[model samples]
Target: MKKLIIVFGIIALTLVSCKNGDENNADKKTAVRKKVPVRKEPKNVSYTLESAKEWLKKNKSKQNLKISLAVNRTDKENFAKMDSVIIPTDLSGDIVFYLPFPLQVDFLQNVDKIILFSYPTQAFAVYENGILIRTGPTNMGKAKDPTPTGLFFTNWKAEETTSTFNDEWELKWNFNIENKKGVGFHQYELPGYPASHSCMRLQEKDAKFLYEWADQWVLADDENVKFKGTPVVVFGSYDFDAPKPWLQLIKNPKALAIPESEIKEIIMPYLSTILKEQEKRKKT
Candidate 1:
């Protein structure tokens, strides 16, 4: 009977030891979990036009000024002359963050180069290997002369070219996509709206950036294009009747947000065509 009691006591001690070990392990796991830091989302703050200017004044820097001007769809010269400007309060000090385009596009991973112009947001984004390299504001065609939405390749380019519509108006960093229609993107005035005459208007710096980055079509003859240049997708439509989309940011920070899925949807129809062109370019 004494032997049986000793065995029972030993078993009880073993079970208690096992229980203590489990409790200690659970405590260790809880402590590890506590040590792990949680990520916090950025606060989206709204600002009035006056408050925006004040904020710009407080956070004065060349980059900040440039970003502010881009957000307002104007250049430094134009922004300086303006009485008030619309500013995104949640500007993370990066122009890329200020714009609505996604940072990475998985669908565009195979694509070497492509430019996207969003008419609704009045912004342009450049993607290389599915990553957003550059983005800025643009003033597309007016309501009466809406910029045609479709896929086009970069064609002829000139440092300084005379506008076909107006002899007096000189277009700088001019890149013509549609020779017949006289449609192209160039350095021009951005009145914070769609004021261009059926062409995409950009800031001087943005125009120059694209001029150097984008490739021009290789010509077989004067009229025929043997090899196409970089692909440009111009999509969506602006609401001329409604207030400017950027202004809506004052109420809703995500008012102009363009989802990655929507961007994928926009590029889906042209994926085959884009791939075919890419393959042909590789061979050439």
Candidate 2:
């Protein structure tokens, strides 16, 4: 009888151990089945005026765009300057027209914004994700004082500032690109050719628009910026021997239209560097 009792006790102990083991295994399985939360990034909602035009053409709607205020008189005049006239309405309820050539740029995915000043074309373009958002005629540095080509960044900006070369010359919406050189983009006279003293001369409206739209570098000290500003690529060269290219626009406006392939070629060289800088900025 004692032997029987012993056997029954052992069986009971074995059963309890197996039950605890099963419970532990079930707990681990429940832990493994738990779902992990995922983080999502914000969607890119910004659209270019060109995209909006095509959308309206196909899916016609009474969707009135919330146009902002006119950048300046020159910006207003630029509407009459280009090929297609798709006017934008401003914040003050003013409708301003601008003509921009269709540019299908698809490669600048790493960039948020880029300013391209082409000396050969005598024009400046503002791009977002490779899409041409805005472009306008520019009077870059003359043959005597040609604007330096290569990659640059927006330094500091001033709403109203005097020219470092001549205090008598008042510049509006001045955004400096080079620190040592007193070269920048600002509202100045455009004589239909390369005229500025190494500056990118733009219309008053373009200057104001860029001033408000562009991101400026934080001044680290008197001479340097804490972080880099927006990228500006000044490429190509003007043939001082020949007449200004835009003069042909009188005969055919499309004459001045830059080929998409050419623009792509200009940006391709600096893209890798720009992307690297952008990544570094994001970390900081």
Candidate 3:
């Protein structure tokens, strides 16, 4: 009986040892296999103008632009070629894309109003966020008599305007809609800044269209008279003739969203013309 019990215990010990060895070997095999691979980032992504909505979804801030303003400057072509050499290189300055007359830009999310400015022109182009959908060209002042460039707040303007000094037919430069302070933008004949009595003009159709563009929907509160929110954008270059204190703030401003090189490139082409004009003065 004692021999039989001892043999049974020996058999159980042998089986347990063999089972443990088999489990250990399986664990080692699984641990030696390769790990899953990681994916890489995409190189570039292309987008279209039609994707404006999709653009806002991805790029919510001004810092993140989905599309760039395609500027083809023909006006300054004889003056300089800045488009090729200026951008994509100097990433730190305000880049002014040269646009033809009536250039259109995308109004991003929450952008209800667009303030437009043209060099030597007195009138400002104002467009509603969504309703108008296009920029309505307005008048500046008159021929030789131009709108002064500088920091300003547009609360209201005056009335009685003409598109042409020769033509009798004229509409409200400030739309004659309401709250006109006797000096506002409206449709007057376009020949030059000397065409008006200090009031900026626009195409009657453009002025009428813009007056109702974002009316009531926009905050008419004036800004940058002494504060900022007034995005004073000038499309043309100025002579070192130097601007008023307010105008100085706009051109040589300290606050900027782009690179210094870009700022240099932007004005460099235009200023070269001024510099040339000045050099001639020195020679004289």
TM-score of each: 0.80, 0.62, 0.32
Report the number of the highest-lDDT candidate. 1
User: What ranking emerges by lDDT with the best candidate at the front?
Assistant: 1, 2, 3
Task: Give the worst 10-residue stretch by lDDT in candidate 1.
Answer: 13-22
lDDT per residue for candidate 3 within 25-98, as digits (tens), equals 22221222222223222232222122333433544444233112221111122113221211121222222211
Off by over 4 Å in 1: 1-46, 51-60, 90-92
Clash list (residue pairs), candidate 2: 67-89, 67-90, 68-90, 68-91, 69-91, 71-205, 72-205, 79-97, 79-98
lDDT by residue for model 2 (1-284), tens: 00011111122111000000111122221111222223222232121233323433554222232121111112333333433322232222212112223344555544678898878877778877665666666778887888899888886676876553555677788777775565688887655567778888887878899998887776555544457778999988999899545444444534646676676677777766666566557677
RMSD of 3: 34.0
Q: For candidate 2, what is the TM-score?
A: 0.62
lDDT of each: 0.72, 0.57, 0.30
List the candidate 3 regions with Cα displacement exceeding 4 Å.
1-110, 120-132, 142-144, 151-153, 157-183, 192-194, 214-284
lDDT comparing candidate 1 with the true structure: 0.72
Question: What C-alpha lDDT does candidate 3 achieve relative to the native structure?
Answer: 0.30
At residue 58, candidate 1 shows an lDDT of 84
